[model samples]
Target: MASAQDAGRGWSMAGRCLTALVGGYAAAAGLATLLARLLPVARVEATAWGMILSFLFYAAFGLWAFHEPRLARVAGVIWGIAIVTGGAALLLGVRP
Candidate 1:
């Protein structure tokens, strides 16, 4: 029922939206972790979660771009989970 253009458009929108959210978080986290030493009071690195959040964010975008609602939903859930506990894991060095 869907045309190729429609599919492509859908995917593009998904990718754009997902990237905006996830990419923003990843950038901020990276800056915080890497720049922590800028101040004498350095904060703990949230580097552990860096990989998962970055991965899931792009994965969700890619999945949604393909119009795979099921997979996109799964990825969205994972993204949510990652955001919720990602910082904790990074702080504690516990892999999620």
Candidate 2:
């Protein structure tokens, strides 16, 4: 039988994985949209760069989620960033 500590660790790992997958993607998408909208470069170039940079953003955020000691704090910060950036993109009329 699995010990209580092992089960708790498993649950924590699952939560971190979920946060990295979902929150990372959300944050990356929001950042890309914001960058594409705010960049001073040409629209095509801006969009291209934004899309390219999104992969890096996702990876970085995923790593951060895994490294964080507190799952709740990680989730809160990641989701907060995603929500704020998404709202900013919408308010700025980013269409992509």
Candidate 3:
């Protein structure tokens, strides 16, 4: 019973959900790795701090994914952060 427009909208919503989950998690992980490396603390403390902050990053990314009006923009920002942070983490010698 759905019209074409409805189907398209459904797909768009689905894309947003996918981005929020996967992209958000990726961004969070990258940020955590980078922070773990950068924090001026003992290794154990820095890693613990990174793990705590990663949850915030993920939640913030998820909220932003929903708040942005354009789907492409949402994907770009989320994925862009993921790539940049991940790349930086790798460059800093953070092990996978």
Q: Which candidate should be chosen as best, given lDDT against the real structure?
A: 3
State the C-alpha lDDT per candidate: 0.48, 0.89, 0.91
> After superposition, which runs of candidate 2 have C-alpha atoms over 4 Å from their true positions?
1-3, 6-8
| Backbone clashes counted, model 1 | 1
User: Against the true structure, candidate 1 has what lDDT?
Assistant: 0.48
Model 1 ranges with Cα > 4 A deviation: 1-5, 38-96
Report the lDDT of model 3 for residue 8.
Answer: 82
Error of 1 at 75 (Å): 17
For every model in order, what is the number of clashing pairs? 1, 0, 0
Tens digits of per-residue lDDT, candidate 3, 1-96, equal 335768888888889999999999999899988999998888899999999899999999999999999999999999999999999988879533
Give the CA lDDT, 0 to 100, for residue 54 in model 2: 97
TM-score of each: 0.35, 0.85, 0.87
Model 1 / residue 48 / CA error / Å? 19
Candidate 3 stretches with Cα past 4 Å from truth are: 1-4
lDDT of 1 by residue, 5-95 (tens): 5897676556545644664354445433433323244144444444335555455544553455464554565455545444544664522
Deviation from native of the Cα of residue 24 in model 3, angstroms:
0.4
| Candidate 1, residue 18: lDDT | 62
